[model samples]
Target chain A: MTSAASSPIEFYFDFSSPYGYLAARIIDAEAAELGRKVTWRPFLLGAVMKQTKAEPLLTIPIKGDYARHDLARAARYYDIPFVVPPQFPFASIAACRAFYWLNGTDPAKARDFALFLYERAFLAGKDISKPDSVLEAASDAGLDAAAMALALQDPAIKELLKAEVDKAIKKGVFGSPFFLVDGEPFWGHDRIAEVREWLRKGGW
Target chain B: MTSAASSPIEFYFDFSSPYGYLAARIIDAEAAELGRKVTWRPFLLGAVMKQTKAEPLLTIPIKGDYARHDLARAARYYDIPFVVPPQFPFASIAACRAFYWLNGTDPAKARDFALFLYERAFLAGKDISKPDSVLEAASDAGLDAAAMALALQDPAIKELLKAEVDKAIKKGVFGSPFFLVDGEPFWGHDRIAEVREWLRKGGW
Candidate 1:
């Protein structure tokens, strides 16, 4: 774990993971405390699952049940307000594409976009799978909503998002929020501490 | 999932997962109640992680913290004894290989062996990783202890164990205890209800 406060930390995420939402709630705050910059990478979870040929989180019986309960418990533990959205697993494709756009143009704006979507879906209980919700989110981030809307339809951006999903698959990521501080992959939201420690030690 | 009582239901397992132990306790009884047979497959969770690139239960933050409390709650819910074994995940290579021996020879005996190991290690506080303890377990199951001890050393049996682990990786299995009937995978011990329902429907 590196103690260098200015180090960069990458967070690969999707809206499908409740723990991702939980992690997002405090990750920015935690990183700020450690004086680290977080790089948000929005990737399609469904595409990643397909490439990895892994079952969705909902398929894991014991873990799935515990996830719902634990998510509520975690929100309380962290003193954050939470609500389960009706259309969960809101189509993450658009959000992922927006992230793809941000990856090239304005990366920090991408981080804000991720947090906006997370808070909307997990805390504010908004349906984020729709394009309009994403547009509203883009507007909230001070980005041109209409321009971002048009960019979402671009096949190249879709392929770009798909390529990142493919990259994550090659790296052996089956789920999110998958975190890699240096070279080591710390999977799931619960692994942030280890990731923080790794960063604290300069990812040795 | 199939309701054909004569046909066995697949039992997917990993040695490191304590919930697998808890599920092993009642799966056979539940299957018997439904007049179905169980086919036990011993798979390596670590190998699955290597294949799918998912983290272990302990490595995942939220899942890890909740697992301790959840396991205790599950024990109470099932009215079963649970001791959280001293060296958890007391390497199941020996136990898994032994299952290979008993699987073909006597599947019922294999089920008994799994239960004994789970009860001893997780409930009675026994170190099942030891050779002597395994021999005792074999003897308790009415198997010849000396012959079983010798059989445990067979390279062919070790290969069989390896094959099961390899097969699990291909099957998109990430954890235990996964239950598959036909092509559908019902992961975790708590998933038995869905497995039972699917069995009632004849197949999934």
Candidate 2:
């Protein structure tokens, strides 16, 4: 069974991550079905990647081709319309900063903004890696575009994203689409099913 | 809903792989339920790792910690008894050569030998990386101990494994526990469920 006091699902994701986009589109409903809420945390995977000394998935020879195929297949499996951005592994720093900036006060709007940025990169082929694009997404989500543009360049907002990534790394999150529920860590988009199981059973 | 012409599920695995061992213990039963057979193909991951330039999973920093945790959690998920070998990442070349040596003529015996070898390494923490261990496992599986011992040193057997690994690479099999069914590729032990679904539905 579930309780009202169960911790919110801490969904740590990078906007540039394709699997993160796929999981992002479904995690909330999975959480909601269990009477749980998910707190979306957008962090830069590049910083975490450096700590791991791992190359981008698509840059790693044979695995790259497999990842390319798997990503498309996984999207179809979830019925999510998808596309690789022209700059596939482009930086999501701007998007992350913008997310944490709003996350500080309007977390709901921040979550909505994060989804838009993901759809921009994955579904619409727009460049959310650009501050202008982030600001446009905020506007499209019915938020203040000009204020968001200023927030994107704000040093305080940049520091917010950095601190969130560091916190995620400290919390043992080294991948996009990582989840923390009941203080247990689950990684990868595939783990979403397991996450639902964990939520429904509390812990198994 | 079923076809007798279905191809065998091509299960490519590395002897030293954790997930591969996990999948090896269950892939046959999964195939059997679908009125299909499984072909256990073992290969050396070290060569594949060299080509991909990827570091071992447990050697990476933050991700390493996550992998160690996930491996145990996944074993629990499948309800399979598991313990990491003390000499994890040990050489599996000998075990692999012996497998192919028997697989050439007596495939069923080779499959049984593979299961014993896997249990020895993962369940009993036996040093299957050794030729002596390979001989002992073959004997334990009711296979010819002397022939398998000589098979370990046979240049012909080594070439068999080499050819198989080369063919696996060409077929885009870079990960352990990779599956090719219906001419579709699925990587990772987690895909076993998807494989069963694919067999039942033919595809999504």
Candidate 3:
């Protein structure tokens, strides 16, 4: 097992996942307290779900109602304002591509861009799936809107996002807010407490 | 909202669910502390899963591995001994029918029988799904073995179990360890904390 001091926690998530948005809100602060760094890797969960033949949580029968309530309940618990987007389960390709495009230059800015987009989609209930909305989030994060638009079309940036999704599948990451701590995979935002405990005890 | 003082918490579960086993371990004590009575209702999750098109946690790709690990990990967290049975996801019809059979006569003893069967299946790694195993658990729970054998074949007992499953589906209980406090529904073992808070505050 890698020592916590040297190994960063790998947080894998999809741009459109509400649980991913919730994890993004707290993982950094939680990790920092433990003197651990976290690497935010945004990938397309739609691609992963397609390969796994997994149904969306809202599409499942009884779980659909419970999940809808839990999503809002969790947001309330975390004191984050959440409104389900009108175009939910929307294509996150544009947002993810923008993240990679900005990440290629400044990783910090990419993180900010990700947070900005999540806030727009989940908090403000905007349709971040659109290229215009993504560009707006990028601009709000202090990224040049015109440069971001061009970068969105960059073949390398698109490939980077695709490669990330491929890597996630290869690593058996099938859910949003999936975390890898010293090669131990913890899925779902509910496992955050267990993640913290795992980091504290160095695995049990 | 139904007052907590008058409403008993409805605990709905399937015998084959590991998470249900974990919840069964502590829900009683947790509820008793708050002066609340718990009604343990066993239903066929298979029927519910069929309607939901939900795969068993161990059958879903990527999630299967995480679920296996989380099952053991959660057991450790709760200080409950758990061993996945060799014949996992075993047919729970016999065990569930036995529960309703015993429940019709004695609710408290039925709870004991449910716990007894869960221990046999999960903690002791026994195949409680088998009639012989169910008979053994029933006998251990102070039930007459010959009578349990007869009850297992009784058409009314079989219909009773089927009715419970139908009722669960109608109530939108798609997952194991589903809890109903008043009219509000909560699913999963992780929601116990929220259940406690809901009881404490009456409602959010």
Pitting candidate 1 against candidate 3, the one with the higher TM-score is 3
- Compare candidates 1 and 3 on lDDT and give the better one: 3
Q: Candidate 3, which segments miss by more than 4 Å at Cα?
A: A1-3, B1-3
> What is the C-alpha DockQ of each candidate?
0.04, 0.70, 0.58
The lDDT for every candidate, in the order shown, is 0.73, 0.85, 0.86
**Which clashing pairs does model 2 show?**
none
lDDT of 2 by residue, A1-204 (tens): 655456688899988889999989999998888777999988878888888888888889899999998888888888999999888788788888888888889899788888888898899998887777787777787888888788888988877777888899999999888999877998889877787777667666
Provide i-RMS per model in Å: 13.6, 1.2, 1.7
Candidates 1 and 2, the one with greater lDDT: 2
Query: After superposition, which runs of candidate 2 have C-alpha atoms over 4 Å from their true positions?
Result: A1-5, B1-5
Top candidate by DockQ = 2
Best candidate, TM-score: 2
TM-score rank order: 2, 3, 1
What overall lDDT, based on C-alpha atoms, would model 2 receive against the true structure? 0.85
Each model's Cα RMSD: 12.5, 2.3, 2.4
Per-residue CA lDDT of model 1 for B121-190, tens digit only, reads 8887877776678889778767788877887899888888888887876665667888766656666666
Q: By the TM-score metric, which is better: model 1 or model 2?
A: 2
